[model samples]
Target: MDLAGMERSSLVKYLVRQLEHFFPDGQHDLSFRIEKDLDQALARLEVCIDAVKIWRKGEFDYLHSSQYTIFLYFLSNTIWRSRQDKRLCTKLFYLNKALNGIDCFYEIEMPDIFFIGHSVGIVLAKADYANYLVLYQNSTVGKNHGIAPKLEEGVIMYPNTAIIGDCHVKARSVIAQGVSVINKDTMPNSYVFQSNSGALEFKPCSKNILGDIFRHV
Candidate 1:
């Protein structure tokens, strides 16, 4: 994959510089392990980028906020999985949050083929996320009473939507904008909307909503 105008080494340096700039306490200096694991993270990112219809298949632009947000999540998650270094992971997590306004921790296991429509105001908790999960701005997937939601494949959470607490979001289910699904279950291939009575209403949808955003949906 092409890293816009930067080489792999330059990208690594850039990430380290950002981390240092954000966390200048001298206790969060990144080790050489980041360089070693960067390739794996980029490889994972490539798979996701290639699946996206709008993004170029083989190019990655660091200046793009949404792309950078996903890349940071991948890098931080990769480092956490490979090295288990909390200090470096914390620094990367904080850097991502500061830059993207998203609260995705390094320890959370995100799917390999998910897409973030907008980086700001998105919070993801420790939920069971499947591939082809699409998240938009101000969307949240959080836990309530220690129970998180299970987002199946091809699930799309539109802008300002949320799925909280023991929700079994079935495949091909689209959560409509500004809707909050709390402790609820959605049928497969359905659209979740909020009625005037403040209750969730499921409507059968035959259209492939994820097909517009993802390839081979």
Candidate 2:
């Protein structure tokens, strides 16, 4: 993605136009603000790009760029958060729908950093997040019984993993595929999953599942 190219320029222009359409707050300097935060935005984008591995050998793959778009939309929302205008929030809220990321609105309190792979059925509610979080497809982290989960750093949620309720998922934990942790406090450095008997299980997780992505950060 060459920022100087016409394609990138046109895309940015279209996004700005969309923001203007939905939010007429008239922040003419919004583009400049995005550019000012480009380093951090690119850093966040790098996490998702590394997580997805769509580009190999320095070659970009257009077929899988929806992941790219997802992260970019997140970055845009994050930048707007710093600006914090009602109209901007509305723009980002609808932008989530426009990006096809179900229930992944921008008003949620996101981590200092995180990654959403393909962002399928990802519902980020009003919960606090730590850094180095990775969310796979169909994974959800939201409130249950009027309480939201608190996620620590280096927590990875595999596909269909749900951490609902007032659960405390400690650092360096991996919620395995199809597992749900509702109202349970997870142990740090553990792997939590579903057993063959349809019950949840937990064990020590000593692997670096997202090492490359975090190392780049």
Candidate 3:
């Protein structure tokens, strides 16, 4: 059971408890600044949970309890709002690198609404993402040259998939495991998979692409 399914009165305590895993030894205090940070993090968390449909059952433990998910959620939110406070941006920049090993330079454009799976590598140097994009483990969404590609909405990249370099992954497209789509444009509702000979193949997606991931949503 997720922790968000617990009593409403203990929500902050619950979040702080999980946060303790990252910030230990009484460092997870409810100070004004920390509370402000939590408020911003929770706001972004709402958007992510909505995207994944984690809130459909009125529970958010899967999000809040996840170190990778919640950390990336907060990191993205901080980067989005970094322009407001230079000092905070610098602080968050290091926190993200130290905690998650995910390097998102402040200049890179990160979508506020997205879900990240475990061990995800996002270089996204110049890439722009649409809503409802799912990134699985060991996957990379980045660029080859200076130019990065744009991903449309409802794109699900399976584990080890790499979408790179000035490509357009259309809406509702599924990038299969270990498939590398470099400098190519994918059709909407298409599936890009790997052949036995290690070649990339494209076909129409016959099954529900985002259904299993966002099933509850």
TM-score of each: 0.96, 0.72, 0.71
RMSD of each: 1.3, 4.4, 4.7
**Residue 104 Cα positional deviation in candidate 1, in Å, after optimal superposition:** 0.5
| Tens-digit lDDT string for candidate 1 (34-114) | 886888999999999999999999999999888899998999899889978788888888888999999999999999898
- Where model 2 places Cα greater than 4 Å from the true spot, the runs are 1-11, 17-76, 196-198
TM-score for candidate 2, residues paired by index = 0.72
Stretches > 4 Å off in candidate 3: 1-34, 54-68, 79-87, 90-94, 105-108, 120-123, 195-199, 215-217
The 10 consecutive residues of candidate 1 with the worst lDDT sum are: 24-33
Assess candidate 2 and give its lDDT: 0.67
lDDT of every predicted structure (CA atoms): 0.90, 0.67, 0.63
Candidate 2 per-residue lDDT, tens place, 1-217, comes to 3332235445456667766776777688656655555556555555545443333422223234354445455665666666655554456567656665657655665665566666657777778788878877888887977898898888998899898898999998899888988888888988997878767678986666767545453
Please report the candidate that would top TM-score against the real structure: 1
Tens digit of lDDT per residue, candidate 3, span 124-166? 4557878777876677777777778889988888887888897
